[model samples]
Target: MSPRLVLVGPPGAGKSSVGRRLARHLGVELRDTDADIERTAGKSITDIFIDDGEPAFRELERAAVAAALAEHEGVLALGGGAVGHAETRAALRGHTVVFLDVGLADAVGRVGLNRDRPLLLDSPRAQLKRLLDERRPLYEEVASVTVVTTGRSIDEVVQEVILHV
Candidate 1:
């Protein structure tokens, strides 16, 4: 099975929130690869990063994303870095991937001081800016449509996503 919609973006881009509402609006389930990875690992993402390291965490994320893309028939929201994997990007070729683009300021505000994010634990603002800059092209490469979520409400973002899907 294939997903009806796939959401990709950096952290605080509202992929999870938008995915949930979009799934409900479309009368389908929402599968988030990050949650799936956490479940399969039997630990939190931060713990995985602490124990196994970023490369290891990324491997698990890649697998989780591939599995979800292959098996899920609902809306799928990918981990922010999923697009960094070449295989995952190739696999997203035919799916309706939406890039939830959010500016640095909005992203920093949305995810402020959240310790759950391992990548942002040190100097969140600068780190987030680097991540957004580095990952923007990858997100754009796989996405069929792009939705700017900066300064917009969740409802507005959801509605914009609905139009493309």
Candidate 2:
């Protein structure tokens, strides 16, 4: 079992939204690793971060990604930082990974002071920018195709992704 499509991007890059629509369009289920981690851990991601710290959360995320990649024959959406793990990046080989590229302005606008995002607790704009900058290469490295979601509608992005798949 494996994903028909895998979406990767920073927060506010529309991974969840696009993943849902894409999966529906493709007549498949959407499995988000973040959601998976939360389900398995029986806690929210923010709480996991607070209680277990980033490293622990990342470990859970890695395992979740591996499980989803191996077991889910549907659409999969990964947390923004999942690409930071070298093992995850290597594991992405031969998968149909899409990088949902979003600009800082669009990202900030979408995420805007959202407290639930554990990484964006301080100066969301700056933090988002840094995340985008730091993770763009990793996203690119793992992606088979890239879709810019900066000003595009979900439909538009989904259509483009469909073309790639």
Candidate 3:
């Protein structure tokens, strides 16, 4: 069977960019769970966060992640917080999950105080670290492999995932 790979990481950890390139290299379609959630919700994710609460947005994300896992056999890039939900984390069992581990500084540099990220809204760098600290264990729990992306180019990260996955 062609390998089905799931890329998980904090926001700005290169999941979407790496996933797209990796999928291209592997000749498989790339399914981004965040985009799936946005489409399913019939609104942009930022809009959902503004109108509905975080809980509601999470529910939508959870649904989208579950659906993508169940139906898609290609590469998938999950939103950073997808693993924080127990049900979603549990669903990852037996699937090959690659954690693109980027440090707080690199992540902040990649994300750049983008308030569009629902969870990071108004939070400082310390808050980003705290969030990563909180979710790190969960990501570790489900990840079949962890690839650090700090100080690495997108090609380097994709090569690492390609070799590992």
Candidate 4:
């Protein structure tokens, strides 16, 4: 079996949190590409980016997403920038991809633009805005359904996804 639902969106858009709840609701496990990449590399995403660069990390992400799409019969959540890669978007074509959209303010509040996030190392708000702008189109391009997550509770988001999927 393949993934029942796949999630894509910007950072702090609640993909991980919402994916967890959605997976629980659907009685399936949650397979997160970011976590899988970290596990496979034996390093955190931040370290991978700093040491190996974005291109290298994207390669790992692409591989992880492909594997999850093939092997995980559950809910899958991808890292924020995963959709930027052409190959990743192509791989999502036949899946039920959900885009969780969040505004800048809500994102900052949720993620705190923390140090652990490699991409947000400097001027987090500006960086996040740029990321959202660049990636929103990609998310829209691949999403089977788009869910706006600003100011909504996890249960609300889960309910909406359940109704759609």
- Residue pairs with backbone overlap in model 3: none
Model 1, C-alpha of 97: deviation from truth (Å)? 0.2
Q: After superposition, how far is residue 69 of candidate 2 from its true place, in Å?
A: 0.4
Candidates in order have lDDT scores of: 0.95, 0.96, 0.89, 0.93
Give stretches of model 4 more than 4 Å off: none
Name the lDDT value of residue 129 in candidate 4: 91
Predicted candidate 4 versus true structure: per-residue lDDT over 1-165, tens digit per residue? 689999999999999999999999999999999999999999999999999999999999999998999999999999999998899899999899999999999998888859878999899999999999999999999999999999999999999999999
Measured against the true structure, the TM-scores of the candidates, in listed sequence, are 0.99, 0.99, 0.95, 0.98
lDDT of 1 by residue, 100-130 (tens): 9999999999999999899999999999999
TM-score for candidate 2: 0.99
Error of model 4, residue 22, in angstroms: 0.6
Prediction-by-prediction clash tally: 0, 0, 0, 0
RMSD of each: 0.5, 0.5, 1.5, 0.7
- Candidate 1 ranges with C-alpha deviation above 4 Å: none
lDDT of 3 by residue, 1-165 (tens): 323899999987999999999999989999998899888889888889899988999999899888888889899999999998999998998899999999989999998878678677776577789888998998999999999999999999999888887
What residue pairs are clashing in model 2? none
